[model samples]
Target chain A: MSAGSPPGVVLDPWLSGVARLVEEGFDQLDLLTAVDLPRDGVIEIVIHLVRIEDHAHVFGHVRLPRADPVLESVTSILPAAAWHEREIHEMFGVEISGHPDLRPLLLQSTSGPPPLRKDTPLVARVETPWPGAVEETTGRRSRRAVTPPGVPPEWLGEGS
Target chain B: MTQRCYAVADRPEVRVHIRDLGLACCAVEFASAIARGLLIPAPEEPGTAAVLVISGTVTDALVPEVVRAWEALPEPKAAVSFGACSNSGGPYWDSYCVTKGVDTVIPVSTYVPGCPPRPEALIDALVSLVVPV
Candidate 1:
């Protein structure tokens, strides 16, 4: 319930929330995205819609359990949500049940945990040593290199 | 050991065709190069494409295709790894899907260092590739 945050809704009545927004003249689906909150153990799906006539904006948010994130497809109500939903499905691993085409929209494959999931490590950072970790020599003592951001300290063990 | 000799073509109207693979943000610089006539666009067909100018991030998914394009080019071809992404994945060096560098997939003749290098940098890389000092 933060400032300017969208009204919250549960997963069960997902379609009805969207239907209500559409009924209220929110004709355009501007954006649909998901946020993976690993600490909170939930994935927040946020959808933004706009009323074409008045340019009024509306946002709807639904939180799903991180372990099993599934939501009813809104493509039927708003056709424009197809691509955004596809991206959400691909990136966040949130299953949008009943979406017509759920193929890999942008990525080459969906072989592992969807990339956007907080648990999924950005492999590039892990595999390659961060150049910033190199010690820089000043006039006196050289500065110690710190760990790369977002990467778990334990993952690198002793010396990164 | 036998010395291998290449027969030089005496065609005065010869032009080096470029296969521009604009993958990400650096492509804006590549486009700027083209818009400014700093780079000559590749023909509709890749047959005459002599230089493969890889500008931007090379994702793992595009590795095979990038290699395929490089292999498809004629002999005596060159590849210019343009921008920091093509050179070493730039800021996306830590991205999950981005390939660290294009050189890991295909051989590169020149590397232009910049997040989005100036159009002149691309021209300079091309010139260096054409005339080996």
Candidate 2:
């Protein structure tokens, strides 16, 4: 664990260690999220926990292989973690192993890849090209031919 | 070729009861127009309205719903595609979530052009639509 991380354990003893934390009164699961690193070939699943008795908090995480990221569900200990697990699965394609109901929690459609992955395709982009200068009607200076963003030059140019 | 034209003052209201289906940024103006009585809100009953006013960017997911709304209106019905988005998807023409133009889904009697057409222009459209072509 980093100096900034609270009392936590590595993947070596994460579940049992956190279960022990629950006994010590860190009873609330504050957050469960993931970060995808395509370059490093690992997807990091981060979780934050809080002790309701005195507001003590800690952050923990486990890294999964990027090819098929998967993690055992924590809902057996913190049932509240279910929705967050489902969201992470839907967004980042992280399979939450042993989830009772791993169905879609937010999106109704299932036509494309998980949306939050860094590799997810963009449906729309307005990257217009910078045209070379042409003679200006005002004669002040040559100016680039302007077109609306997202429109390609071929559509604006004369002839097919 | 020879042509003939006819005109008649059929309905006493001098206007078609407009059934509005506004989806995005243009909904605010549609509500404002309805509240101001510039456009008569059609009754809930199907096949009663004479015009279907579509304003805003409609996605492919909502295309079937739009067609259902159009089919609900009575015969001799006219449709107005308002704003740039409905005309050609405005700023999101290339977006997969946005339909390129409303005409691809429904026949249009008139198209009002503008990102969000000025209120004066909308009023002018209303005046022109008062007489069916």
lDDT string for model 2 (A1-160, tens) is: 2123333555434467657767778789888888887767778778888988788887777778889887888888889988998999988898888898988876556567786776664344433333433345787665776555534454445212
Candidate 1 wrongly placed segments (more than 4 Å): A1-12, A130-146, A154-160, B1-15, B37-49
Which whole-number lDDT from 0 to 100 does residue B31 have in model 1? 70
Scoring only the A-chain of each prediction against the true A-chain gives TM-scores of: 0.80, 0.70
Best by TM-score: 1
List DockQ, one per candidate, in order. 0.60, 0.22
Error (Å) of candidate 2 at residue B88 is 2.8
Q: What's the CA error at residue B11 for candidate 2, in Å?
A: 14
lDDT at residue A25 of model 2 (Cα atoms): 82
Positional deviation of residue B118's Cα in model 2 after best superposition, in angstroms = 3.7
By TM-score, how accurate is candidate 2? 0.57
Global CA lDDT computed for model 2? 0.70
Q: Which candidate number has the best DockQ? A: 1
